[model samples]
Target: MRRDILEHYKSTGTYTYAGPYSEYFKSLPDDIRQLGNLICSQVIHRVTLREGNSGANSDLRYGDMTRFPWYRLRCEDDVLMTAAAMTAELFRLDDRGFTFQRATENKIVVT
Candidate 1:
């Protein structure tokens, strides 16, 4: 399942820009489509350094266990804001790292 997600990321650059969500979305059950869509609508995406970069500069790069680059889910809008709060409540009960300020209106900007 993990490998399948990595393959999907390599084939499409969307997840790299949007974060490592395609797999998480795909793993969702049919009943959870709404939640998945909510995640899609709210999370900001980002890509990490390439595999080869580690050899060139350790500080500048790191390898992900998955072949695809590591993605950061930026939470900045109502959709993302809600989602982050929910995710934090459920999975990160003790951690508030998932919480973030509302992003700028532009989807591409993290603000």
Candidate 2:
């Protein structure tokens, strides 16, 4: 995903999170941190499928899904986002959607 973002940026000379994904980048540290945030946001906003590695495929054979809700996240690149925020964002993108009430209700766990 990181490579994909870099290649996309190299080709388009434009960023992914300069618009819709900005809020997710807002919490990132300043300086070089924003670059990481930008790259991550772009990948997450662009890629699809959050499944972990499966024995059926070599690429899916490695990776930890317990610590990361790979199945819940729509984008494999979202691992870089705050766990809480990413979870919330995923929930927001879910069929049920999100609401301020749900956000405050601890439905989203950050750690």
Candidate 3:
């Protein structure tokens, strides 16, 4: 799964979240971290499958998801977005100080 995820990013030129959230991510339980990675992989795969089935050209723009090959979940921006959302939901489930916020258009603040 990790290899596939790396290959997907390489082939698509999509960014992955490797920023300041590293510490927080590392602090997560092994199972949670694995699940997050898996979710991220699935998100990319599903989007690619949808685009391929839609018969549209794949778009590799920085932040466009309307056309084919959109970077909905294949870029750092989307990854952070998903992380923020997931953290918020998971925090509600278990108040574990795993907080993420979109500090800017392309930046994520994790705590």
Which of the numbered candidates is closest to the native, going by highest TM-score? 3
TM-scores for all predictions:
0.20, 0.23, 0.25
Compose the digit string of candidate 3's lDDT tens values, residues 39-91. 33222233444354343424422222343233323443344454445444444
Candidate 2 residue pairs in clash (backbone atoms < 3 Å): 53-60, 54-60, 84-110
Off by over 4 Å in 3: 1-21, 29-81, 97-111
Tell me the lDDT of model 3 at 69: 30
lDDT tens digits, residue span 1-111, model 1 = 699888875563422332434454355556566655543432333432223235443343222213332342343333333333344333333232222222212222122
Error of 1 at 13 (Å): 32
Q: Give the top-scoring candidate (lDDT).
A: 3
- The residue pairs found clashing in candidate 1 are 18-45, 76-102, 76-103
lDDT of each: 0.35, 0.38, 0.39
Arrange candidates by lDDT, highest first: which order? 3, 2, 1
Candidate 2, 76-108: lDDT as tens digits: 333435434454455555434332222212122
Cα error, candidate 2, residue 16 (Å):
1.0
Displacement of residue 6 (Cα, Å) in model 2 is 14
